[model samples]
Target chain A: MKDDYKDKLDSLPVDIKLRAADRLKIHLMRQKYGYFSRLCLLMALIGPGILVMIADNDAGGVMTYAQTGSIFGIGFFIPFMIVMLPVAYIVQEMTVRLGAVTHRGHAEMIWKRYGKFWGAFSLIDLIIANVLTLITEFIGITIGMRVFGVPPLISSISAVLIIASIQLFLRYFAWEWISLSIAAFNLVFVPLVFFVPHLHWGAVARSFGTWHIKGGVSSLFIYVVLANLGTTIAPWMLFFQQSSVVDKGLTVKDIRDGQFDTFIGSVFMVIVAIAIILITAGTVYGLTQTPNLDIQTILSAISSKMGPLAMRLFALGLVEAGLIAAIAISASTSWAMGEAFGWPKSINMPPIEGWKFYLPGVISLLIAGGIVLIPNAPLGFLNLTVQVVATIFMPAAMMFLLLLLNDKEIMGEHINKHWQNISAFTIVGFLIIMNFMYGLTVVFPHILG
Target chain B: MIKYIDIIGFNGKRCDMKNNKKTSKDINLDEDWEDFIKEEGLIDYNKIPVQKAEIKGWVQIAFWFLRIYILVMIIMVIIGFSRIK
Candidate 1:
């Protein structure tokens, strides 16, 4: 019987054989171990969700959280971040199912199911957003390294080499593990919060009850809230997670473990985010000092108030955030391109066999890193471009996600329930209104008045 | 046998077997591609309802909003770029 099975397997194509081997390994593991096999199964299926959520707390995201604490003193955003936990989970969990059930990346599903125009639209938006966002990550990485006395050239080259090596050399499993190992450092901010002198636990607790908007519903408050929402969920995330899930070879049976992974990741993201907020709110904002709280200003304030150890740890967290996000975004870009153009895409493929697949991501990363190395590269404008592109494409991305999630034929028994749709629609509506508000504020500066 | 193998692995693009004639080793390939597709629910992709009128209204509204949003953002980016320069 074993020989017969071997014979049948030998007859299959290479792609199908690779998939079958992976499936058979999981099947054998489950067959050998009964109830405890679940742990093993989860270990295999944990990458996409956790990686996605952690990467969501990218360099820009960390800065945004710190700014939230510094500008608003963490009164509103602490509880607000807590609320986003479920919102993030609900939105991301749908991708897990879509990926597992369809066995196609989000971009592929969009292109195949919906026609050329919308598909091309989403692909362009995703690639452009991803490239611009990668620039931000590289910027963050360089800036963080600078805080530690590393020059920008050394920082950019080192980051580029590190990220390129990870993508080019490692397979999916090793890639996920290495990336997670780095992502664990993002928790350094959680501990750094303790270094803030005389932080009152009661004040943090009271903010939830006092959930009132601190300075009334002014335009700044609105802008901060929209920034938070935008940071929490974005276009790249949907493509990244879904493609990662497909690349990981998750099936419908793995959805439960996938959801568990996303939940744990969301919890980690919220915790780290809240910790940054607490640190800033306790130290910088508590000092009643709010003057141009960009990331550089916030880091300096953290150093002055919390001392060097705390500052170094925050810098380390920023570096980790940037590194992990760059890694994930680069991979997602490769996967999206492969999916869109029908190229053979799996990290499982060696660089030699899959250079076409890896070329786009590597080229984009190189360009981003090169741009960061240039002196006075109009980084402010580049940053704005990233933000503007993300804001523009968000509604369309959210709409595609919702439509795919609700398709009866595709999702079948797993189609979203009514309440789930309601919750998703509410989130979408909130994002749309926020996008318009943000756009108007940009186009007409006095609209806030 | 060669025809059977070609049929099994046949993607939309034409199978170019001009240089390499049929060999018996090619017959070694088995497992119908149709079965693989069925098992993976590949056909269900086409069955997805992208243009149902019931859903078209909301989708249309979203596209319109997205179009206007993209235009405004492009202008905003240009203005931002100029200001920085």
Candidate 2:
């Protein structure tokens, strides 16, 4: 029998034989336990962080950067994005520690560790934010598809189907890699920036030195800056990454790698965001200043000046950004709700184990997908509200994060140092001041500027 | 194939420090480890063992408000925006 097996194996293609041998070796090694064996385990366990960061640059984010590029043309915000690197890392790093330590979603951690009122509050906030965020993702999908001459109805339905299919069918490992693949496309903007004609590298560098805004602080510029911040750090990110850290089974040991994952995602996110800004700031800024610069107008402008090919690629980036974020946001909503209520929560679990967790996301995606079909759903206003609402809640979220990260009992050796505390406090102070200034500026524009 | 790098890697963008095994080790350390180890004891200010289930009322409420404020803002913003243009 052994010789017969060998004969059959020998007859197989070399590639097939090598692949089979590799798998067998890995399986055998995994069966022999130790630190080295963990590579297999690690492979099985790497998704949620990348998803959270990529999803941070959602369809709305894509459009925002698209508009930023068209309007600002990439001077200071390019360097501004460098600060964003640590900003995103600092903020998300807490969620990694929180999840590994507490084994709870942000909502559940607040509710159970804190109490019912805050717990209920977090859940309500997370759900609304998640739902509204999903709406923006669908808007990206519908608009991106429209560029291909696909109708909104067709585009939204297809997007919903694709999103639901990924969520419902795959177990955790399969689900994560597939999502990461989509996220990889978010980098298209980086390359797309190079395609802009007569791109002014000198001027781009000069803007960083000058740190010039096309005009000084106006309501529009403040709104734009605030909206950019909103897209960078949405409320959904808090819920998404924490729930993700839990779902991915990141314990204190895994927290190191998880933080690494989030740091990586943050870097990519800032780069892609800046690229979109650079491309637009280079191309679009000073050329036009229309509040109505949705994906189509921006792409049309790029297409007219660049070419249809470059415009098509930009559309592709928009689609991937929307799709990846929708997947993450939907999963986040499902996971946060699941963890908070003490229902089963994991993509790895069969639906029988976690039906409640799975269903809300699916249902939410459908509603969002359906919303695109509504006549004049006021997408522009919806997008803006998503931004302003997110900024208002920023302080409250940061407060909870600071309090938790500072809690020596919970965080153990991971507690914020003096510098980290200073950074966090400074950011919190800055955010609070900004939020207050935003409200004040709204009330009396001439006062600050 | 002993291709661990291939299996778990990211795009090779210059800014992409994800798979740089050495640097990845040092990411997201929010504190000075040695100092934190020396300083943070396993007890709270009132000198009680910090148990998970027994998290105090005030601490819990602080967290709950952190979360609830998002939803409240959502409702407020929707209302506020609805009133405007």
Candidate 3:
């Protein structure tokens, strides 16, 4: 646009500009990672994968882990989550490849490769599930805000506006950094574990060696387990990662770096989950020897054991986690819908160019935020709906991801190898079992919630 | 046993995407940097375009079997829970 700059730009050798870009990238990475560090490779490639996995353990997820620890303690779930790190990583790895190679999102791939029927189904399911998920996020924020004595009305409205402002202004990279900063607050639960008096290191160690459930697979145990699984590997993750990969302009070359990002996110997720469990298990379950406790029980334990300050911190962490995940998941919803319908889609695009891409996420945040204000909506019921919908939807979502990944037409030689297949199938089988057990737990609590 | 497929086993490094046959122009990539992207660990990128001759129907079938296996496992769990109640 400027004649003088245009001449300068033309005068610069093409290789010089390319080298400048690469050097600038290296310099920035050095600033972030320190000099002579190679692991900065991941730092450069760490967007979609890390974001998806962290967002998976949203506000609802932290609550579930806390409730599980308060009710059942960390006799089993801690080690189980360590095992699940790979499970979450395995399922998510497919998206990195699919996004990089296909240059498309999950919804677009489905519509093109599978058919319209399944594509339409995935689009609708993604939107509804994401909206419901956002509602749960609002639930988390409102409940957590109550700890700070903030009125629910102001908290929900303020939360909605903050999320909208971030979405409206920041480009993808800046938005991602801001969201990642909020996600880092999820670490507050880790320190709370230390505040718990006389935590038995022996019991925590035993959980890994034995993986025991305290009360021998009761309905509550199964329900908690299902809730945990649903929270960890929800359908939104697939939509989020694939769409993010496409949006990030990740080519096939970025796949490994992407997987590394995913691996880091998974480790962070597990650690945060274990922290909540440790904090609650050390305080509530150990103190009361209670069975079948709920989220309120855990929150009260935090308040009683760690004081109002710690409790407020926990609630603040929940609000931030939920708010950040809501942003990511809501974006996932719009992207998936746009991909399915062949609408222009990208966080990088102007709102006008991609209004449809912006629509679903905005509407979801607004509606969910409003629902949070609706004089005590049947929120417990809504949480259950989130779990049930995710359970029903997960297999179909995984099925398509697995099929597409293994497809030579789409993935070329990137198809699942023997060991990878074994690992993935095992996870899928385990998830299905977990979901079925959860359904039964809800139906016959005495037998399994 | 169905998990033992080699379809995705091979890890890849960088490949020439500019000449990749499967690469499409529909993608609005940064045209100038088409050759600059580099993945450190992802193997699939090394293979570039999946060679059609490499299509493994057996692997696809194996993946399908695993899917049904999960469904069957869920059905069994439901039955077990129902009977227990």
Candidate 4:
């Protein structure tokens, strides 16, 4: 029977085979160790959630958190970030159910259910946001490398090669494992929090009580808030996690384990975000005279304030952030495209079988890397544009997610509860309002006035 | 173009039928339509039945609102980018 099953699996397509292998592992684990299968199940189901959340704390995300601390201090944003934990988990948890129940990625579901118009809308938004976001990752990589005396050309080339190889060589489970290993380094920011001079537990504690904005309700404050929101829940995250859950072969039976995975990821994500905020808030906040410092300048501030070791550690964090995000985002682009066009896509496939699947992601990375290496690219503007585009498209993504989650046909018994829909729609409503405010400020600089 | 409903003698069927009483080998066909007809019990093809989607009235309203919302966002993004010299 086992041999026959293996033969059947061997005849299946590469994508299906990968999912079957994952399902088989979970099945075997449950069959073998009935009592302690919970641990085994979590171990197998841990990748997609942790990868998505930590990758959410990407280079751009880390920079935003750092800038948050440097600009506003940790008073308001730390508590705000802690609040984002449930927000992120609740939002991502729906994707788990959607993927498991439907056995389809977000793009496929959108296209198949909502017709071509919304499908094309999501695809275009995702592709543009993904490419622009990849440029930021490369920017993070090159900038972080420059701190270590590596030139941009060498850094970009090495990064592109490493990212491509991560996608091309490893299968789904191995790819997730390797990506998680890299993502673990994002924790370097956590310990660096302890290096803060005269770091006060009281201030961090008092901020939750106060929940006060330092500069009051200003345009820069709104910009930073929108940027944090952009980094927290973007369209790519929705696509990426749903596709990953599908790829990992999670079913309705595995939804509990999936939620557990996302919960763990949310905890890790918020902790790391808070740590980056602390690191910057400790070393750079009031000590520096400049109110508006770029990420590089912020790194230099950390170096001068906390010494060389801390500086290098922070830079290492940046590299890891960029590298892991590149891996996940590249895979996300591949998965989204494949699902949209109904092409074969899986990290499990060999180069020959899945070259069509891998081409778009690798080419995107290459283009982003090339853009980063250009002599006089306006990286700051590019970064802002990425954040802006992501912010703008966020409502559409959230709306689709809400619609899909509330759909009785697709979700059935696993549909969103009353509280889930309320919370999800509330978040969507907040995003629409924030996008409107951000747009007004962009169009009319004196709108706030 | 023999309808599965004609063969099974059950017209006006929606996606409610979920019984997998027959396997693919029983039909001796590997075509996608055969799999769909058997797997989904989609015997009725005369009326344009809603396959797996259930977009009712309020849902339709929400969907169109989102469409307009997304369009406005795209415009805002264009304006935002154009200002980014």
Query: Which predicted model would earn the best DockQ?
Result: 4
Q: Is the docking of candidate 3 incorrect, acceptable, medium or high quality?
A: incorrect
Candidate 4 has an interface RMSD (Å) of 15.3
| Candidate 2 CAPRI-style tier | incorrect
The reply for model 1, stretches above 4 Å from the true place, is A1-16, A32-34, A286-292, B1-85
TM-score of 2: 0.80
Candidate 4 TM-score over all chains jointly: 0.88
Q: Which regions in candidate 2 have their CA more than 4 angstroms from the true location?
A: A1-45, A446-449, B1-83
Off by over 4 Å in 4: A1-4, A287-292, B1-56, B78-85
Against the true structure, what is each candidate's TM-score?
A: 0.87, 0.80, 0.80, 0.88
Candidate 3 chain B: worst-modelled 10 consecutive residues by lDDT? B4-13
lDDT of 1 by residue, A1-449 (tens): 33444555456553344444454444433333234444655676687888899999999898888888887885889899999999999999999999998888888888877777778999998999898899989988988999899998999899989998889877666688999999888888887877788789898899999986767766677778988898899899999999888877777877898999999999999999999989988777745434236787778888888898888889888889999999999999999998888887777666876798899899989999999888878877777778777887877887888888888878889999899999999998888788777666666767767
TM-scores of chain A, one for each prediction: 0.96, 0.89, 0.90, 0.97
- Which stretches of candidate 3 lie above 4 Å from their native place? A1-41, A286-294, A441-449, B1-85
lDDT of 3 by residue, A200-263 (tens): 8888888889889887877667677787888788898998888887766566756788888889
Of 1 and 2, the candidate ranking higher by DockQ: 1
Error of 3 at B10 (Å): 35
- Who is ahead in lDDT, 2 or 4? 4
lDDT of each residue in A194-307, candidate 4, tens digit only: 888878989999999999898687777788888888888989999999999877777777789889999999999999999999999988897653435788788888988888
The per-model DockQ list reads 0.07, 0.07, 0.04, 0.08
Query: Clashes in candidate 2: how many?
Result: 16
Per-residue alpha-carbon lDDT of candidate 4 for residues B1-85, written as tens digits (9 for 90 to 100): 1100111221111111333233212432233333422332222111222354666798889878876876777787788778765
